[model samples]
Target: MAPAAITLAAEAPKLSSANTGFMLICSALVLLMTPGLAFFYGGMVRVKSTLNMLMMSFVSIGIVTILWVLYGFSLAFGSSNGFIGFNSDWLGMSNVGLTELWDGYTIPIFVFMVFQMMFAVITPALISGAIADRVKFSAWALFVALWLTIVYVPVAHWVWGADGWAFKLGVIDFAGGTAVHINAGAGALGVILVIGKRVGFKKDPMRPHSLPLVMLGAGLLWFGWFGFNAGSWLGNDDGVGALMFVNTQVATAAAMLAWLAYEKIRHGAFTTLGAASGAVAGLVAITPSGGAVSPLGAIAVGAIAGVACAAAVGLKFKFGYDDSLDVVGVHMVGGIIGSLLIGFFATGKGQSTATGVFYGDHSFTQLWKQFAGVGAVLGYSLVASAVLAFLLDKTLGMRVTEDEEVSGIDQAEHAETAYDFSGAGGGVVSSVSAALAGTSKKVDA
Candidate 1:
C-alpha cells in the first residue's frame, strides 16, 4: 500500500501538465474566433461604422475577460445547482496545484476555464452586431455583463456543466448549437426589438465598407476553428475530437458554396456577403454536431444549413423586425438546424453511429430532444434578454438619443470615426456628407 501511494504521487504532476497544455491550446483557439467574428460582421455593415462593428468584437476581450476571472467562471462552470455556478470565488486559482479531476490529462482546470471563457466572451459579442451603430457603449458593456450572468452562464451550465440538467438528460451539444448560437441569436433579437432599428432600415444602400476586412476575418475564423472543435475533447488525442476537426472544415466550406449559390440565384450576383454569411451559418450548424457526425454527414449538414439560413434571413423582411445584421437568420437558424439534425443523426452502437430517424432511430426521440433543448434555450434567451433590455433601458438607457442617431453613433457616442479622408480634404467632403446625409434623411422619410 505504501509503495502504491508513492507511485501514484509521483505520476500526478506529469498527468496534470498534460491537461494544462491541452486547455491552453483550446483557449487560444477560441480567442481567434472573436476577430473572425469582427470580419464576418464588419463586412455586413456600412463603412461609416465598420470600425465600431469590429470594435464590439475586440472590446469583449477587455470586458468579458475581466468578468470571467472575477466571478463569471464561477457562475458558469464552477460548482452550483441547475440555475448557475458560484461555488468558487473569482476563480482565485488557489493551491497552485493540479486539480485532481483533470488528472486524466495534462491540462489544468484553470486552463479549461480559460478555454471556455473565450466562448463566453465572443458569444455575447456576436449579438452586439445586431444592435450596432445605435446603442451606447457604456450601456452595451453593462448589458453584456448582465446577459452573461443572467442568460449565458445558466444556459451554459444547464447544457455543459457536470450537473447540468440537459447534460444529465444525455442531450448531446457537441459544441454550442443551442447554448451559444441559438441562445445569443435569440437574445440579439430581443435587445434589437427594444432598441429599435438603425435610423435607416430599408432605404439606405448601407453596403459593406470593407470586403477585404470581411474576407480576412472569415479566413482567420476558418483556420482557428480546428482547435475550437478538436480541443473540446479535453485531451490532445481522441477519435471524436479528430472527427469534429474534419467535420468543421467540410461543413464550413460546404456552407460557403451553398450561400454563394443562393446569392447567385436570389440576388443575381455572388456577393462577398454570401460567402461570409454562408460560411458562418455552416459553422454554427455544425457546432453542436461536430463531435457526433461523420464527415459525409457534416457536408450534408453544412449544405442544408447554408440553404436554410439563406431562407431564414428573409423572415426579418416579412415580419418587419429588421434583424439588422441577421443575427437571428444565421446564428439562431443555423443553431437550430445543427441541433435538430444531430438528434436524428447521432449514432452510438455499431449501428452506424447517430443514424437519423430516417436511418434508424426512427422513433423521433432524438429529434424531440433537440427541439426541446432548442426551444428551452430560445424561450429563455428571448425572455431574459427582453427583460434585461427593458431594465437597462429604464435604468441606464438602451438607445442613444434621436439626435445622436442622426449624427452617427461612431462620432456622437464613441467619439471615434472608422476612417479619415482628411488628406483628400474637402475634395470628397461635400459629396460624401451629402450622400450620407441624404441616406439618413431618406431612411427617416
Candidate 2:
C-alpha cells in the first residue's frame, strides 16, 4: 500500500468588519489632530503670523499624504532585511486590493495605512511650533517634504517596522514617544539652532494673541487623543484598548492639575496657558506608555511629566536657544519622562507580559532599552534636521525678510491676514442698525 499523504490546514487572513470600522474612525480622528494643532499653534503666535502657523500644519497633511502613498509607507512598513523597509510588494500600495488585510491585523491594509499616515503628517507639523513666526512658508513646505523622506521614514522603520532593530531589541513604544514626540522635539531644537532667534527674542513680549482659540485647540486635541492612544492597539480589544482609554483620561487630568499647582506655587497664579500646556505634556507623556500601564501608572507618569515639562520650558531662556513655542520642553522632555518611567511603572498586565522594575520585576533592563530608543531617534532627528535647515538656508533661505517678519508672516507668505479689525466699525454700525430696527414705539423718546 502507498503511504498516505499528509496535509496541514491553516486559516487564511481575512478583513475584520468591526476592527475595520474602528480603525477607519480612528484614522479620521487622528487626521483631525493636524487642524487642531493648527489652532493650537496659531493661537499661540501673534495674530500676524496666525495664518502661517495654520498653513504649516495644514501643508503637512498634503505633502506627507502624497509621499506616504507613493513610497513613504513602503519605506516605513514594507518588508526589508532590517533597519529600513524598502520592498516592492507595498510600493505605491501596488498589487494590494481593497480586501487585502495587513498581516496579523484584523483591519484592511488600507485602514492601517491611513491611520499611520496621520502620524507621519503630525510629527513634522510639531516642529512648526519651535520656529514659529520666522520661517519662510516655501522653505517649510520643502523641509517637510525632504525631512519626511530622509529622517522620518528611516526613524519610523527603525522603531515600528516588523523587522525594525528597536522592535527586535525589545524596546517598548506603544505609540510614538521616540518616533513622534522626541523625534519632532529634537528636530525643532536642531532647526532653531541654525535659524537663530526671532528678531526681538528676549526683548519682545510675544504672548499668545488668542487664549480662547488655544483652549479650543486643546479641547479638540484632548478629544482626539482618545483615538490616538487607544487605537494604537490596532484592534478594539476590551482589555488593552479600554485600559488605554481610561489611562489617557486619568493621565491628562492629573497633568493638568499638576501643572496648575506648579504654576500657582512658582508664579502665584494658575494661568490658562499653564493648563493647556500641562494637558499637552500629559498627552505626550502617555502616548508611549498608555498601553503598558494601569490608570494609576498613567497618573503618576502624567504628574511627573507635567512638573518636569514646566521646569524644562524655562530652560530656553537660560540656554539661549530660541524654541519659539516650547516644543522641546513639552514634547521631547515629556516623551523622555514617559518612555523612561514605563521601565518602572509597566504592570506586565496590558498588551505585553513584561513587568517593569517597580512591578516586582527588579531589573533595569527595560529602562536601558528605552534610553537606547530615545537616544537613537533624538540624535538622528537633531543632526538630520540641522543639515536640512542649513541646506535650505543656503539654497532657498529659511527665514522671511526682517521687514516681513516684523509686519506679519501671514501677509508675507500667504498675502492675507487672519483678522481685519478695519471691519469693526462696519460691524458695530450694523449691530446698532439692527437694534434700532427691532425697537418698538418706545423710540419716541
- Write down the TM-score for model 2: 0.93
Give the whole-model CA lDDT for all candidates, comma-separated: 0.79, 0.88
How far off is residue 85 in model 2, in Å? Answer: 0.3
Worst 10 residues of 1 by lDDT: 1-10
TM-score to true structure, per model: 0.88, 0.93
| CA lDDT, candidate 1, residue 433 | 77
State the lDDT of candidate 1 residue by residue for 240-328, as single tens digits: 67678888999999999998898899889998878988888898898888877778888989999999999899987788786878899
- Where's the lowest-lDDT run of ten residues in candidate 2? 1-10
In model 2, pairs of residues that clash are none
RMSD of each: 7.1, 6.0
**lDDT value, residue 76 of candidate 2:** 88
In model 1, how large is the Cα lDDT of residue 363?
Answer: 80
Regions of model 1 farther than 4 Å from truth: 1-19, 95-105, 349-355, 424-445
